[model samples]
Target: MSLFLTLKVALRALIRNKVRSILTMLGIIIGIAAVIAVVAVGQGATVMIQEQISSMGDNILMIFPGSASSGGLHFGAGTRSTLTPQDAEAIMNECLYVKAVSPMVRAGGQVIYQDKNWSTSVNGVSPSYLEVRNWELKEGAFFTDSEVKAASKVCVIGATVAKELFDTESPVEKTIRIRNMPFKIIGVLVKKGSAAFGQDQDDTIIAPWSSVSRFLQRGSFNSVNQLLVSATSIKTIELAKTDITSILRQRHKLSEGTDDDFSIIDTAEITKAITATATTMTMLLAIIASISLLVGGIGIMNIMLVSVTERTREIGLRMAVGARSKDILLQFLVEAMVLAGIGGVFGIIIGGSTAEIVARYNDWPVLVSAQSTVIAFLFSAAVGIFFGFFPAWRASRLNPIEALRYE
Candidate 1:
């Protein structure tokens, strides 16, 4: 018989038992859909992370005063307050790869503007912060170096704070109270969404380090907390870190083996780590989903076996009329493939849309790539063949005489 005739027969058989056929495809549908949704969401999250890291400026290094600890154990990278504003300035002036540096002073207090009030983080930095972090001003401008030198009461507002206090009105030139100290609004930062660490990117205030130090008292911070530095290129991040370390050691007058007080966090290193983690998660999810697909394939094989038993007399009739074993196998295989193909089609649609809907409602980053859709569909088809072959082979190998004599 021709391929078309075999397919027509198989499809007719499926249509005869519509409910069973639909139920048999259920496992495949769920498996394929789950694969697509999980992969798409994972890819989206990875992209979001890269974007956030990039927005914070590439080739960037962060140096912190506290010791780096994970799971309550300190491993390394914790530096003492040996990094001063002078060290930051020396890096920019001395290191050939160093582009800009911003030594930070972190503080938290209630910000009061007229009748509205909100508590948020306050970062005391320099004019170079915008360059180091790749931050852009949506309105107004950053504080001038002279303003910082004089510890002027000028500040830059984050998107969230601006919205809360100004309500779409221009916040420029408006005075808001930070811990009762009046600060004139100089700039409003563009919204930067969120980071992989779940930190809000546009929720903190930026001010001159001098202003913060003078307002909060300079003696309170004997050592600088962190140094945000940007390098000329991604390749030069290591060079910049090495040069900065030497500069700090010489400036701080540290003896050998005392342990470096400051640890540098390279943006490229961070991005690589995040990508590795995301890839591992994706692989694990795909493996779990594949198990479900395997189970669904087994269900297909079981159903096909039952079908062959029920249709033994029909097979005997065909064989007695000179039909070959190959013909019998072809018919069964076609049926299995058709069932799987339909399930895969439905699964792709269901999974893609489900992922998109979830991402949209939850404000999650999600991208359903064509590769994932194609892979899921192909996996479903492969599952059908792997599971359906055994039953098809068994049915084809049956004795026509015995099948005919059976009641």
Candidate 2:
């Protein structure tokens, strides 16, 4: 028989048991939908993480004081105050690959404006802090180098702090008290939602490092908590790190054999680590979803076996009337393919809708690519062929007399 005739016969057979055919396709539908939805969600999370990291800065690097050992015990990084404003200045003046640098000193206190008081971290930094952090002013200008040198009580508030303290009002040119000392609010930073670690980025205050050291922290005037540095470009990040390390070691009078008193972190390293983790999670989810497809294929094989058994006498009658074995195989194979093909089409529709709904409900990003949809459909068709072959061959090989004699 021709391919078209075999397909017509298969369609009639499937239509005779419409309910059974629909039930057989259920597994394929669910499996494809789950795979597509999981992949969409995983890709969305990866993109979100990259965006958050990029908002931190452009080619940024952070320098923190190294750990100090006491009584044969070692303290963690940032436990020592070995980093100084002079070191940051030297890096800016000497490191060729460095673009900008800022010295930072941090303290925590209650900020009071009128009757409103909100406790937040106050970061004292040089004017270059904004440039190094890639932060922009929403209202007014940043503080100057002279202000930092004079330990002026000028500050910039983050979006969260501004909203909490002033509500709808712009915080520029206003005054707020921190640590019982009044500070003029010179600027408001543009909103940054959150950091990778889930800390609120726009929930603090910024001021001159000199002011924070003198008034809030009461620590050594020469010491800074950390240094924020920006490389000229991404390509120069490693070079900048090496140059800064060499410069700091020389400034700190570290010998060739001695350990350095500071640590430097590259933002690119953090990005790589986070991306790797996201990729692994996506692969795992995809693998788990694929197991359902395997199960669906098994269901198709089982259903086809029952179909061949029930149609044994019909098969014998067809063979006795001069039907070829290849024709019988083609008919059953086409039936299975039709079932899987229809299921795949519906699965794609359901999966795309599911992904969109999940993204909307969670306020997440999702991307549904055409490539994934096509691949899913093709895999379903392949599953049909692989699992339908054995039953179809068995039906085609049955002896006409024996099949006709069966109940």
Candidate 3:
């Protein structure tokens, strides 16, 4: 028989038992839908993470006052005020690869705007903090270098802090209190959303390093908690780090044999770690979803076996009327494929809708690519072929006389 004729015959056979055909396709529908949904969610999460990383200047490097250890023990770069504002200034002035640097000093306090007060982290930083972190101004200008140098009482508020303290009102040129010291609100930062590390980057306020130094001056003016630096390029991060370390060692008067108390972190390293974690999660989720497809495939095999038994006499009659074993096999396989293919098509629709709904409510980035949908549908078809083979082969090899004579 021609291919079209065989397909028409298969369609008629499936339609004759509408309920059974629908029941057989259920496993395939569930399997495809689950797989597609899981993978789509995973892809969306990965994209969101990458976007967050990219937003905070890909070439940025963070200099903290501690050393990273592998054995979960704290030893190096510990118990010292190792990093200082002088080191940050030295890097900016001396390092060729360094583009911008900011020394950050954090203090937790209640930020008061009128009667409405919010507890938040106040970041003492220079004017270059905005540039190093790639922050954008929403309302007004950032504090000037003179303001940072003169210990002027001015600040830039983050979006989250702005909303909590000022609501929808303009915060520019207004005064807010940090630890009861009034500082003029110079600007509001643009919304940064959540980073891959789950840190709300836009939740803190920025004040001049001089203002913080004077107000909370138990230590030296040159000393700071951490330094945030941005390199000219990602490729130049190693050069920038090496140059900064040399400059700091010379400035801090450290000997060749003495271990440096400062540690530098490349943002690219953090990005790599986050990407590796996300890739692993996506693979694990995809693998788990594949188990559902395997179960569905087994269901198809079982149902096809039962279907062959029910249609044994019909098969016998067709064989007796000059139908070849290959034709018999092809007919059964086509029926299984048709079932799975239709299920896969609907599954794609449902999966896409599910992912969109989740993203809409949660405000997460969701990507539903054409490649993913096509792959899912083809996987379903492959499952049908693999699982339908045994039943098709069994139906093809049946003895025509015995099949016809069976009760």
Q: Which candidate has the top score in lDDT?
A: 2
> Cα lDDT of model 3 overall?
0.85
**How far is 365's C-alpha from truth in model 3 (Å)?**
1.8
lDDT per residue as tens, model 1, 221-306: 44567899999988888888899888877877779988666777888898999999998998899788778878788888888998
TM-score per prediction, in order, is: 0.83, 0.88, 0.85
Clashes of each: 4, 0, 0
User: How much lDDT does candidate 2 score?
Assistant: 0.90
State the lDDT of candidate 2 residue by residue for 289-407, as single tens digits: 98997888788888999999999999999999998898888888888887787877887789888998888886767777788889889988888888888889998999999988779
**Between candidates 2 and 3, the lDDT winner:** 2
Q: For residues 64-173, write the lDDT of model 3, one tens digit per residue.
A: 77554556666655335778887888899999998899998877788898899998888899888878888789989988888888999898999999999888899999
Which stretches in model 1 have alpha-carbon errors above 4 Å? 1-6, 49-55, 66-79, 114-116, 220-223, 232-243, 250-256, 267-288, 313-327, 400-407
RMSD of 1: 4.0
Stretches of candidate 3 exceeding 4 Å from the true structure = 53-57, 67-79, 93-97, 113-116, 196-199, 233-258, 313-324, 399-407
lDDT scores of the candidates, listed in order? 0.84, 0.90, 0.85
The deviation in Å at residue 387 for candidate 3 is: 0.5
Q: By TM-score, how accurate is candidate 3?
A: 0.85
